[model samples]
Target chain A: MAIKQRKLELGVLVASLALVTSCKREDRPFQTSAPSAEAIQFTRMTDFRAGGPSISGNQPSPAMSADETPEEKEFEENAYMVGEGKRLFSAFNCVGCHAHGGGGMGPALIDDQWIYGHEPAQIFCTIIEGRPNGMPSFGGKIPSFQVWQLASYVRSLGGLVPGDAAPGRDDDMHGGPPENSAPNQKPNDSSLPKSAEMPK
Target chain B: MIAAATARWATLADNDFGVTSGEWVRGTKSVLDPAGPQSGRIHQLFLDYFWLSVVVYVLVVLFVIFAVILRRRRARWTGPILAEPAPSREKLRGWLVGLATLATTIALFFLLAGDHAAGRAIRSLSTDNALKIRVTGHQWWWEFRFEDEAPSKIFTTANEIHIPVGRTIEVELHSPDVIHSFWVPNLHGKRDMIPGHPTRIAFRADKASEYWGQCAEFCGYEHAKMRFRVVAEPEEKFNAWKAAQLQSSVQPATDSQKKGQYVFLHTTCVMCHTIQGTTAGAMMGPDLTHLASRKTIAAGSLPNKRGHLAGWISNPQTIKPGVRMPANSLPPDQLQALLDYLEILK
Candidate 1:
């Protein structure tokens, strides 16, 4: 009987040690450095399609988009970064066009449909480099680190970020449900279907 | 040690209160110094109430003392006495008590009548075309909107209120958040500004002077610092001020000013504040069209100096904690340019 009790005690100690070792380690918000361009990767329509439309205007044409970098990992996991990004979203006048992701002048960010790729790398590129019609380029204006933070926040709006890291409600008017309570949406790349018509 | 401390306190008190002259000390915002008819009526009512209470107290105390003296003189011995009370004496005491109660009731009735008369005078203005100004009370700030029939003529300003002297100024009070009370002791009594329930208060300033007004209600953080100044000026001066406020922001003349304007439009400043004739039109914050023209900034918490403005722009949290305006991380050159641009806003 004494031997059985000793075995049970040893089992409980080993189990607790495993649980502690598996606990998540969080990086402080706004403390990380910007990731290198080589770290970012994503899928473009041109890469998948046999023949696709060429990139138009002064818009940037990167190879592809959305393979999570270590810097992005830090942003999506930190709750403070998400909250700070929500504040910056208003301060940078993102709500002026997006209107809390419901889409006024710009397209809705909360919806599943992504004109560009729905990956974090793709979102970061779209903000840093201006799109065709209305989306202004904030490359030289906002710091690169802040742009990454904003991308993480945008992902949260679509219920893409982790639930624990998402922001809560604002002190102002109750516009809609908060980002944390947002339902998960599977990203659908709409650009792939219309990629066959190539521009000379 | 205690005696020494008391002696020092007595000397300090003597220095503060001891006077050779018979002149009364009147504060700049004292209710005793009536600048309008509304305050004058209130002052008179307060005086009447004060003197009436004093008279009643004195009479009661004297009557009690007189009764004690009479009873002592009429007593035969100091020990317990066996004496029958007279029916006439009891009847007289009943009559006296009834008379005192009647006098008190009459005094209260008179005060009620005075209060009603003051209320009527405060509500009813002599002229039909009183200047209408809508005051919206925020957490710790005041927004004043001067209404007009024409949209072009309508303008909004904050903190400092200017009105033409000798004219009834009608103010409609509103609150988007918690309850606040607006009180200009020199001009009018405090009136509650309840959220969702609009209230109105009318008063006319007879004197051409500046009077300070403060938030009478206990609001959230920095409530004590929530203050404004009422400038009662001549009709011509008031109109000129109004005309200047109606105009849009001026175009930048210097290179630094242009850079400053660019900084303001491009940064978080544009996200909240509005500068007329500029693309930075957002109503979430105050309208900075005529900001430089105003005497103070941050809802009259700080003087409108370049140093103060710089400190406020860099870190407003340190100066006024929990304010909605975030700290802008602008370089020295950009901050200087911003100040130059703002100064020309007048």
Candidate 2:
């Protein structure tokens, strides 16, 4: 009778230990898998359709999902997210210091002189951890997903590709005008330049 | 006693009362004469307005006193007596027409004169070369950058501006943050400095002198403390001073200086100020690259000395309340070292 009782106690102890070990395993951080071939293909299609560079793994679109319906997919691909980002950018008064993309008190976001990396994650980090020189940290003010969308809009301004976009094709996104033209040229022409020449 | 009190009040309002005895103030009197060439034009306009205002005030005061004294005792109780009203419509019309014509003429003259003066000050090309200085306004301080100099040759001074005597000095104003106004009473009027917009002001001092200036606009809580000094020196002395300011800071020779440099890097100072050629590249605050070269500290509110610098670094808020610069707590050794290092800014 005593041996049978000891065996039951041991069985109960072993079961409790096993349960604790499983719970610890569940607490481990999630490890994401590397971008798959299918993901890359889908990103490229979206980038090409959007008239941007082929998407890379570094810049995965936040809304990229294979499970979404056709209607949902159309909304993600169109100007809805970009429009939301534009509204947030103005609402937050980013243009007040940035001055319509022209550098002023703050560094120009539209220009190529990015102190932080141009990647979405990098841009998100910058907004989260504000840089020196009068920039405030908006991590608490803005939601994470909204920050990513804002980053996407800022990336789009210089006409850079989204994540999963092809590299070395930045020139294809130049829809407005060519490199050089007279200062007083018409805006509709492709020959209009980007900026005025510096004083001699 | 009442007569004596009245006499004392009258004397207190005289021009000679409470006059400053500083050398700078005396020099400014001669150099920045209200009757001088540049100021003379503006001076006349101001005088005309001043006399007009004085006359109006005197007439109003006299009328009030006369009406009070000449009032009938019975008339006080019986107000608005029943009597035949006089016809004053033609007189009223004539007065209105005369006043309108006079006001219009005065307004037109002022507008044209002001426009002409402003045009001459900003755009007129002078045969005499002007001394150019780029003045960048930060939150509560001024950064003076001289033109026609190399990167290494660049000198960053605060608050005090040094120009040669008898030369037109052109100040190109730019603001890094909010709007700031630059004004010196004896030198020139206030000019607004807008972000992304640069404005220029031109003024000349006839003699070697120092003039006081204050940020006229309500910029921030410490706006009143944001003062500057314009030091117009002899041509040769100005050149020498500029050469000295242009030179690189002397290296830290003592152990205290080395320790101060270490403290500067480890402290909050590194987060806001920049000491050029060092890792402190922060543009949020005034560049302390050549701090020792400046004549005054805390935006000209205090003299730049070892004790004041230490006090300022220790508790800036106590000296200038609501200043954006935070007061940093430091040990005695660290504060001493920092002061030692800063004293060699030239």
Best by DockQ: 1
> Per-candidate TM-score, first chain only?
0.71, 0.43
Give the clashing residue pairs of candidate 2, or none.
Answer: A53-A166, A54-A165, A54-A166, A55-A164, A55-A165, A55-A166, A56-A164, A56-A165, A59-A163
Listed in order, each prediction's TM-score against the native is 0.69, 0.53
TM-score, model 2, chain B versus true chain B: 0.74
lDDT, candidate 2, at A110: 51
DockQ of each: 0.12, 0.02
For each of the candidates, give the backbone clash count: 4, 9
Over 4 Å off, model 1: A1-96, A99-101, A109-133, A137-200, B1-28, B63-77, B80-88, B194-197
Best by lDDT: 1
What is the lDDT, from 0 to 100, of the residue B129 in candidate 2? 76
lDDT for position B25 in model 1: 18
Task: Output the lDDT of residue B144, model 2.
Answer: 82
What tens digits encode model 1's per-residue C-alpha lDDT throughout A78-136?
A: 78677768877887889889888788999888877788767777787677656767888
Tens-digit lDDT string for candidate 1 (B211-235) = 7677899887778767777889999
